[model samples]
Target: MQPDQVSIATQGLLKGRRVLVTGGARGLGLEFARHAGRAGAAVVIADILANELHAAAEDLRAEGIQAQSVVFDQSSPESITDCVVQAAQWLGGLDGLVNNAAITNSGGKALNELDIDVWDKVMAVNVRGTWLMSRACWPALKASGRGSIVNLASDTSLWGAQNLLAYVASKGAVIAMSRSMAREMGVDNITVNAVAPGLTLVEATEYVPKHRHELYEGQRAIQRQQVPDDVSGVVTFLLSDLSRFVTGQVMAVNGGFVMH
Candidate 1:
């Protein structure tokens, strides 16, 4: 489906919820923001891509969704804190946080050949960034009295995909961290969950080899390329009041690629 035609079945499911999505300039992040906004939540999309971020928020506004944009660098701690402040201020408070910013700089490189700097960068953004963003958003989310954190993981980590050690390891950390965070934050009525998507067809995965893409497609039960919407709905559900009792869980939305 075209971008404008992407329909969210649960309209007003997130009514009165304020959401902040990281790396929301394009691809899956953008789609998650769109779905949340369509579900009746005001959204703030933060990204390092200034131009695309603003343009995306404008597009959402044009569609009559309450949306805003903030520019932030996921690798920088100060930036992550500032982004949360800006987003929370804009939305009055944060009800949901989507930790979607991540890097695959170590992609296509074997563990032995991967540069230390590349591995560190991936960890800094994918692992540390998620932690800090969630930390910074904690107060606002807790104040909302019903907060949900959705951390973006990858199925590559579950199946131990080769030649992508840094990213895989980082997402695995995210999965573990989400569970820990959930256990600690459940007292505050906050839910922390991880969503692991497969080899999705998004801008971020454009560099994935054709053979790898075919491998994902041929091995999946759905037998087709996965789109952003396939995962966005679950994310929206998690962010909404519907999942108030759910916490500390990992939902793999990979078309049955990793059935666990």
Candidate 2:
């Protein structure tokens, strides 16, 4: 959905907030940034894809959102640290963080069949990257005094989806980490939570098998295709003041695919 089409209910929800979204060049990450911007937040979108990242920021700017882009590689701890420093500098301290950058190199491969290097890469980016980025942004988030962190997890982890062991395990770790991080950061007024989305239709998910999509559609309570819009609103709420009392929780925005 376009930034101009943001729902009236969420307008001004994040007024005066500053947020940084990882992997904001495209897909769900881009949608999260758009929603945050529409809610009146100053946003910095970080990604490894420099060209697409800049283009997305320009698009957000055209819609009158305060938006900027930074390039960073999630697999590198140095890059993650630098990205947070640059983002926080641009935003004058961050009120919210969306850890949405992750890789699924082990997709379609069983644990036994997955290459060690691919599995390592997935864990490095999805698990370690999330940890490092959150740590790097901790001080800035805490300084905001009403900080919020939303880690983008996957429903696959909850249900134990096969053939994607590395990705599933990585996201599972994120959910667990969010809980512990919440407890530690709570004293500082920083809310940490995880959002688990199931099989959304986006550019990154185009490689998902048709059978898997059908399975999700058949099993979901909503009985329809999942879209980025469906999940982005929940992330925005977590970032906004409305959820100040909500933290250390895992919300599954999967149309009842997994109610737990």
Candidate 3:
């Protein structure tokens, strides 16, 4: 959708809604929060980075946006539950959740070279974290009657990156979990979906090998790397009434890098 069309559709569409975004301190998560706030939703930014999360929240508040921040470690089950409860209380209720917290093992290590500890850590945050957050927010979301959950996935899972086995597997799990949750929650009027983003220029992806990035560049039909805003718009749409009929789908935001 074009920017103008999105603006028209979401003009105050989320007015009075409350949203929670995990890992929302920076990068794409920040972008998602900004857009949702601009659309008139009260946003709760949660992240493991206390300082960064607070700074982001202050910045949003500076813009006169209704925002709050909470420190949350996605890899820890206890932290996930606590964060969800805190956010729900802060926001007075919950209407949506963006499971954007994730970590890629340092360097694109193949499965054989990947350390077991790193593998477990990745799964704990990326896969298990998503499940825990969603489950924890189930009751609050059900209360909203118009609940939506957007899980952050990746193009690596779709095309199978050569050396990011652990990250790829986790993202693949996110897609599957999202589908199942969508099916299970559909009867309750809750919508669950995943956003599989292509390689985007962010602090996290800066460490990716140049050659690997070039490979992604070549695959993108648009011939350009993705930006945070590119992915944020779709997330906002999915959380809005515009996509009320959409669920259990993986919306790829990779500039056509992984078309399906």
lDDT of all the models against the reference?
0.92, 0.94, 0.89
Please give, for residues 57-77, the per-residue lDDT of candidate 2 as tens digits.
Answer: 999999889999999999999
Q: What is the lDDT of residue 74 in candidate 3?
A: 92
Candidate 3, poorest ten consecutive residues by summed lDDT: 1-10
lDDT of 3 by residue, 1-260 (tens): 23344545566878888999999999889878988888889999999889989999999898778999999899888998899899999998999999999998835677789999998999999999999999999999999999999999998899888788889999999999999999999988999999999989888788888988898888789988778878888999888888898999999888888896
Clashing pairs in 2: none
TM-score sort, best first: 2, 1, 3
Q: Candidate 1: which stretches are off by over 4 Å?
A: 1-6
Cα displacement (Å) at residue 121, model 1: 0.6
Q: Tell me model 2's lDDT, rounded to 2 decimals.
A: 0.94
Clashing pairs in 3: none
Off by over 4 Å in 2: 1-6
Question: Per-residue CA lDDT of candidate 1, range 206-227, in tens?
Answer: 9998999999999999899999
